[model samples]
Each structure stands twice: as C-alpha cells, then as structure tokens.
Target chain A: MATLKDVAAKSGVTVTTVSRVLNNRGYISEETRDKVYLAMKELNYQPNEIARSLSKQKSNNIGIIVPHIEHPYFARLIGYLEREAVKKNYKIILCNSHAKFEKEIDYLEMFQSHRVAGIILCSRSVDIGKFVSLNIPVVSIERPVDVGTTSVECDNYQGGILAAKHLIARGCRHLVHFSGIENEAMPADARSKGFIKVCEDNNILHKEVESKADDYLNMEYHSLIESVLKENPEVDGIFASSDLIAAQVIQVARKMNIQVPDQLKIVGFDDVSIASLVSPTITTIHQPIKEMAQEAINCLIKCTEDSVVPSRIQLPVSLIKRETT
Target chain B: MATLKDVAAKSGVTVTTVSRVLNNRGYISEETRDKVYLAMKELNYQPNEIARSLSKQKSNNIGIIVPHIEHPYFARLIGYLEREAVKKNYKIILCNSHAKFEKEIDYLEMFQSHRVAGIILCSRSVDIGKFVSLNIPVVSIERPVDVGTTSVECDNYQGGILAAKHLIARGCRHLVHFSGIENEAMPADARSKGFIKVCEDNNILHKEVESKADDYLNMEYHSLIESVLKENPEVDGIFASSDLIAAQVIQVARKMNIQVPDQLKIVGFDDVSIASLVSPTITTIHQPIKEMAQEAINCLIKCTEDSVVPSRIQLPVSLIKRETT
Candidate 1:
C-alpha cells in the first residue's frame, strides 16, 4: 500500500503541498495537481477514506469480472451477486473483460490500484497465470483460475452426462455433440469429457463439432452443423453445450427441412430464458444461477473473515425437459 | 457533499480524531473507527481522491443508473457504453436500480457525494424533479428525466408506425397491439401512440392489451393475450411494444395453436438477439444500440464542455423483416 509520503516523494513535492492538493484548501497550479494525481496513481496511493478500510485488511467493495454482461447467464449472475453484496454491506464494481486477456489484465490492475476487498471472476482469460500475484482475496465463478482459490461451478460434467442419457432415452442411437474447443485455463470442457465417456460406455456412435471461443455469432456453428449433418445423414440426436447453440441448431435444422424430435431429438445446456423462449422450448440442463452467486459471495466473505476458503464448490445441475426431446 | 468536519461533528469526535482515523495513523479503538466510518457514510462524505476530482470541476469517473443489467437491451447498451467510456479514459460505476425508487435515490446520493463527472441514466424512476438539483452534468439514456436534460431515445413512435404499416401492407384487416402501460416519466409509450393513431386514421378495427411496469414474468401478458385472442380471433396482425413481449406472445400463441404469419402476423420492438433467436425470427424495429450508446456518451461529454445540452435525441429505428411478418 502506497502513502501520501510516497506520492510526495515521487512527485518531488513537500508533504504539506500534497496534503493541500488532497484537501483542496490552498491554491495549486494545474500542472502541480496533475503531477500529484499522476504520482499518486502511479504509486497506488489509496485515498484516506478507502485507505482506512484497506488498512483494516479489506474493503467494503468487491470487484467482479465476467466475460460479457450481455450473456443471459452472466447478467443474471451479476444481478444476484449485487443483491447479495448489498445485503452484506458491500458494493460491487463490475468489469466486463469481453473475453480478452489484455482487458482482463487492465481490470485486474485497476482493481489492484483501487484496492477492492476481493474479486469474483467468471473471466474467459486463457492466460491467467499472473493472477497469483494478486494480493486480494479471490473467488472464482464457473471458470477455474488457479489451484488455491475456491471456485463455484455447476456440475458441467454431470450436466453433459444427463444430456447424453436423455438423448439416448429418447431412442436416438446416432448422436452428435456440439462442444467448444478445449481450453486449459477453463475447466468447462469437462462437458466434452462426460459426453464422450457416456457415448463410449454405451457403444453409441457420436460426432463432436468443436467451436472456437468468442464465437458469439452462430456463423461457425451454422457451418459446422451444416457440414456435420451433411456427412452424417443418420445423426438423429444432438446435444448442444449451450441453449444459444441449440437454438441455432434448430434454426439450421428448420432451414434444412429436418423435423425436430420426429427425425431429430435435441437437448441443450444452461436453461436460461432463451431455452424456453425459443420454438419447441428446448429440453436443457438447468444450472442454478442464483444459488451459485450466493455461494460465490459466501466464499469470498469467508476468505475475508478466515483467509481460508475451499478449493472448489460444485453446485448440482438438473435436466429440464421441454418440448425438444 | 459532507466534509470531514461534518463527519467529526456527527460522530461526536474531535476533528483530529477523525483525521487520524481517516489517515490510519496513531492508535484508534475499533468502536471509534466504526463510528467514524458510519458518520462519514451518514453524512455522505466522499473519499478524498474522488472529492479532489470534484473540486477540480470534473472527474474521470461517470455514474450510470439502469433499470437492471439482466435486461438484454440494457446489458448490451452497457457493454457499448463501457467500451466507449474506456476509449475516452473514463470509468463507469454501474448502479442497477432494479426499478426501485429508493435504490435510485441511494445511487444518486452516492454519485453526488462521490462527485462523478456526469450521469447516464436509463432509470425507471418516475419522479425525477430532484435531479434538477444534481450539480453534475447528466445524459438521459432511453428514459428522459425532465426538462433541460439531454436524452437519447429510439424513435419508438416511428417504430410503431412502421410496424402498423407493414402489417397493413401485408394485407392484415384486423389488428391488436400489446403495449406497456403508459408512463409519464418514460416516453416509451409513444410506440403505442403511433400504433393507435395510424389505426384510427385508417379506420381499422384494432385492440390493445397493456401490461404494467416492472411486470417481467409476462403473467399479465399471458392472460391478456389469451382474452384478447378469445374475443377477437379475427385479429390478423399483432404488434408488441418490445421484443421480449413479442416473444412471449409467440409462446402463448403457439400453445393456443395459432400459426404465426399464417393466421396472425406479429411485429416486435427493440430487435435484441432474442428476436433472431426465436423460432419464426421476429420482424422488429432495430434500435441502433451501439450508435445510441456512443451518442449518449457524446452528449454527456458535451455537457461537460458546455453547460447546455439538447433536450432529446431520437435515433432512427429500422424494421427487420424475418419469418414472422
């Protein structure tokens, strides 16, 4: 933690001058004020009020980073987090990293300089090795960061297994799974593992269509689904990792004149609003968003109190059967 | 804004004690520290760093109040605003008022004491007369506060006209519109105005179902759509005030075995992602989200330079014809 003395020394100003600038009690030139503020920022000189809380070893503010606020899951997650934080007398400062590693770094630096008490990260940053250097308590949400910090994640592997089992129960032997490309940093690809394992155990033939990250648009999914359906004309069941992808699959399936549930049975994951709003009301896996948010906040608060938090917190996921299956 | 003197007075402590506590120097009892922090919060004393920016007449921080981040429109709008704010080296502290008047008041007070450079409001607060007393510049987004404040809103009235005209052009004789209940503070009800006026001028028999504000679940919408259809099964065209409402209408209509675009044509407002994701992709009025966010930021920045800003800015909305109409 930097102090006023450090700022004064770095800016080559007297302690009295720095105090006057901070208090706004005396006349100061624009250049001098700019120099003081810049030096303070450079040295991470937290203001007296927040600094008091910082000295107490925590702040009443928690920083949260999510990939994109527009995503339904993240939006709802943040809403729940804010409500929980308010109940705990904490403020939430949101950072949308947009799945970019550099922006993630920028927000982390900002959080460091501002001295937020903790962080709840649902970031998609692949290069998060630098996170270990962060001094603040951290709680991971969905995305696993490092070895020490606790993470609140839905049972993606179990969710994937349910999807596979449901499709099989629907009497679809030739199945396909839409999986995102594997990332070492994020353990969400466990969905792929569960799906593949189940298919192998059942001696069922399955195809996997992998997608790159940050592919919000269905262009890649559209092309991939088109090619997969073209090559494997016998494919009858499709399990998509996300409802958005499932909706797109239905769109492409409709365009290709494939009657859903009759010739093709589909199941999706993350029973967000889009799952029900889409036509045929996708049968999907329901990740408890509100419960997960509460658990994440509780984990961070535990870290604040005892500095010892769990390594992982896995919530249960259930299959929501709608019209698709 | 409350000064340190006010906090000391409120806490019934000496000025030196408060200063020492703030600076985190010298011995201070835990109870005394609690008293000081509480007094500062009660008096609304901003931290020195933000207060310094207040004294300098501008800040690199901006306060934003929106109804809720979970709303797709607001989530995407916030995403764009944050990107633009980052480009301009400004930080956004988001306040999700969640359609609560008290929370909106709380955020406004926080902004006032913290001395943000400006405010970009998409709040649902009806009584905004107190905003005139806000010293900082303000830019209203989506919802207009009052006179003498600049606002960014889509041409909702024109959107209604476009939808009505398109439905008529598609050979619809009878029509029905699902509208949000009229709000004096929010001018969004103009969508219904345009729809009704065009229908009256053309002497078309039309019905309307209105939902109350903050009624997100669409229970009112479901019952209203049901009754409206039962009374007027001859309704050949329908227009919903928003894409979310339109999507709900589609869901309920599907349950009733009403084939979209064949028995009933539908048009939605605010072409959010849900419009395209749903089966029978909604034909909606596309509100230029990114451009509007940029314009809102521009308006706030302009207010910082010159004290005066325009009363309202209405961006154009284009109808996106998909499978529905």
Candidate 2:
C-alpha cells in the first residue's frame, strides 16, 4: 500500500508539507498542492481517515438515534436524512433506542466516545441534562429540548387546526381526535390542543382519546379504535395523530359496516406512504419531512462551526386531500 | 477530558501500561487491571475511540448499504440488523445507494477510507471485482456475489414453491405471476424459476408479467398491474414477488370492482409489515428476515477473524396464510 511518506518522496516535498496539504491546515502554494495531488494520484495513496480524525478531533459521521426504524414515519425521515447528509459529505451512524431511556443513555455515551461531529435525536426519552453535558452539537427532530440543543419540527398545532376545519367544512357534526401516548411531552401533543380549540370555537361536539405506549410500540390500534367507534356511533369525523392510526381507523370502520367519506370522514397526520396505500386513501396533513431532515442536518453543521444556531425552527404544513375526505 | 497520562499518574503506572489496558492488546495482571479501572473511574476518563481504532487498524463500525431505506422490507431488515449488531458491540454506518451504480462506488470508497471492520452490501449495482480487490471482508444480503465475498439470502426458490402450492391448493386454475425488473440478476429471480417449474408440473395455465424498473423504484405498480388484470380476465390467482406489489394489486382490483379471494386469490412474497397492514391482510411467504440479518452479521464478523468462511448461506422460508388466500 502507498503511504504518506511515499507520496512526499514522489512529490519531492517534505512529509510535513504533504501532511499540511492533506489536512488543509496551513496555506500551501498552488504549485505545491498540485504536485502533491499528482503524486497522490500516481501512487494511489488512501489516507487513513481514523488517524486523520484523531488528529483533527472530529469525524465526518453524525449519530442518529431513532425510536423505531421499522415505523413508516421514521423510515421515511431516515431516508431523507441520508440523502441530505450525502449532499453535505456526512455519514450517519444509526441507533435504535426502542424508546427506552437506558438505551438512549448508552448510545449517547457511545457517541461521545466516538467523537461524532454531531447528533440528531429522534427519540425523546432521555433527559435534556445528558445532552447538555455531552458538549456535542445536537439537533432534535419533533422533540423540543432545552437551551443547549437545537430543534426542527413541523407546525403540529397548525396541522390540527387544518384537520378540524376540513372535517367541519365537510359537514361533520361529531368529531373525535385520536392522540399519541399520554404524558409523553412530545411536540405532537400540541396537535390535540389545536384541534380542541377549533372544535370549541365552532360549538361542535368532540372527544379526545389517547393511545397507550404499548399500542404505539406494537403499531396495533384495531381493538381500541373499534371500541371507540362502537361507543360513538354518531361520530362522523376523526383526526388521528399518525397515518398508522388513521389506517387502523379505516380498517375498524370497515369491519363495523361503516362507509368512509359517506357515513364517516377521516383526516390523518404525517402523510406517510400508508396514508395513500390504504383502501380509502386517507386525507392527511403533509408534514415537511424532507425539509425538516435537511434543516436538522444544516443546524447541526452550523452548531459545529459557530455554536449560535437558532434554537427552534418550525416549518409550515399543508393539507393533502385524497379519496377519504 | 482526562487523558491517558492522567490515568497512568493516578494509577501509579506507565502510560504504555495504561494504553495496553485500554486496548486489551497485551497481557496484564488482574490486580494491575483493577487498579487501572479504579483510576479511570475516579478520574472519569473516556478513551477516544478514534485513536484506539487507529492503533488497532480497524473500527467497530459496520458499513451497511441498502438500495432504499424507505422501502418496508429493507427498513425492517435494517431494524433487525441494528439489534443484532448491538449485541456484538458494533455500530452501523448507514448508506442509501438508491440503486445507483455511482452511489454504490462512492460509498464503497468511503467505507475503505474509514477502515470499517466489514461491509454489508444490500445493493448490487457495483462490480464484484471492486469488492475482491479492496481486501475487506464483505457480506452481500439477498444479492449474490462471486468469489472473495460471502452471501446470505433466504430460500427464494422454496418461497416461490410455497406460494405456488398455496395458491393451487386454494382451487385456482388460472394464475399470473408479477416479477421484479427484467435482467437485474438478483438472487430473487430464482422465485420465477421455482414458480414456473411448479406450474409446468401441474400443467396449470399460467402467465408471467415483468414489472419495469421505474415501477419498482417509484413503488407505483397500479397502472401496470391494472393493465395486466384487464388483459388476463381469466386469471383467477396472482402471486406477487413483493408485498408492496401485492398491495398495489389489491388496490387495483378494488378500483376495478373485483372482489378479492372471491373472484381472485392472491399470494405475495417477503411478508413484510405491509403485507399484514394492508386491507384484507395478504397471505404470503415469510422470508425469515431477522434470522437472515443475524446470519449476515455473524458471517461478516467471522470473515474478519478468519479469511475462510462459508461462501453462501441460504435460510429457510415459510408460508404465512392470511385473508388473501
């Protein structure tokens, strides 16, 4: 294998000059840089990136921790993140925290040891103090953090308002909102707040139901949704916090002999692939997933350089009308 | 920010001894190791993994390249791989090739530069010779490679037989098979061979339709499948190569007012989450994704320790009967 010494000898330059050219540490003349490049090309020398990272005290890798990779929402988010990271010449180190606090702590420690350039946290079980003490740049997605970390999310509250208004405009008198796990303190909780505000302002009848952590983890809400539908036969509209839950609502409605968009109307959030793949093709609030991913990467990079990035950024959301509504 | 020197001073040992203890490179007495551990704990020392990896000439990162991270099959596979990798104290460096030749080459070069312990290739666009010459241990999943690389795949041929027999046993005479793109040379192509042989033995009227590359990449097979159904109105049974395609078949059938399992019976492959999540729940062949992921990681780790390893490993598949059949 070709070494740095070989490239230096071939280029007729000192090893320090070659090292400086490789690291871009000190200014080098154009002629010297061109000569070094030509020598490196000729010798086919591949610099050891680990050694370079050790000297520079940083790696071009970003640690990404997600609660569940198999979930469509996170899966799509990760895909967009990978695409944007490649554009910025960064790689992703993936960790599945499974929504467990201990696993999140373990992964945070691992990231510290590896000296990753930054972290993107999609899970929200860990304490904010742990991330603050790590002293590494972090960007949380859809999870609000304290002063030390930056966050990027969609307009969840606005999304809820849109869903409620759409259902009302479609002549739905009785509405129901299926929310995420209770007391999780996620930014998504604002969704129900927005929905309730719109319902109260319109003087409409509405109810809010919270899904349990087990239902979220297992991705099974059939029984819960079925019970809700049976108890509220007059309910004509539902706004689910996620597309997965919305798909289940459609399934449960079907089993109960309720026709969608005729007897019952539905609107889902996140606008993931399942929203369209389902039978009724659910109407949904389109969260700017790709944009949020790009913003998270950009924020982490900015924090690495300046440490003065905006602490919170909320992008706009829109309603995508499909067959269901 | 305690350094090696600080730990050595606190433990009353040489810096070299502390380094050896950290890397587990050389023999050290239990008492001396215990003293070093106590010193590290008291000083709150964290070893820089980059420096340790440089000294060892290898990293604890396993490079995983997949064609599409948002696809449910690959997404589920990655989730399982991450879980298994964690058990072995390894981390995953994720790359999405998007089924592009240039992207695969770029990621391969980057993995080489980073000195990843091994690579798991889920994309098959790159030349096999590139992997052979890199002198790195590689394991290809569901993608067959020539000599100098290990491969892990489910029994695709057997899966095909199971799908065919299940459809036939359900009293379907006229059948149609929707295959992947033509001339891709993926190990999955064996599915068609098995299906064809079974059809020939039974002398059942059957037709095979090939999906274009765009359909697979975009995950939009509605038009293609609808056209096939229109042309082959006598086709009473259908077997799709992937759960995604099968879901599209159901959607197309519904649009055409054709009742599933009453007028048409269907069987899908891969049995990913999408299979069960879709309406009516697809009956399909299960690929044993978790076991395959474990085997792939184990094969890569074995290759790192010893150059000799099983060139190819084929795990078993099964039939998962559901409402579709």
Best by TM-score, which number?
A: 2
Candidate 2 lDDT tens digits, A26-136: 889999999999999998788999988998889999999999999999999999999999899999999999888799988988998899999999997467675567678
Report residue B269 deviation for candidate 1 (angstroms).
0.3
**DockQ for every prediction shown:** 0.18, 0.78
Instruction: Give the best candidate by lDDT.
Output: 2
lDDT of each: 0.79, 0.90
Off by over 4 Å in 2: A24-39, B11-13, B24-39
Q: After superposition, how far is residue B67 of candidate 2 from its true place, in Å?
A: 0.4
Tens digit per residue, CA lDDT, model 1, B49-135: 433343454456678888777777887888889888878877787778877889888777666544567888888745555555555
**Which CAPRI tier for candidate 1?**
incorrect
lDDT of 1 by residue, A1-325 (tens): 4678999999999988998898796899999999999998797564554333334534467888887778777777887898888778677877788777788877876665555778888886444444544557788888887776788999999988999988998899999998875453444488878888899999999987777764643223677778788889899999998888898888888888999879999998878878887788899999998899999999888887866778899999999999898
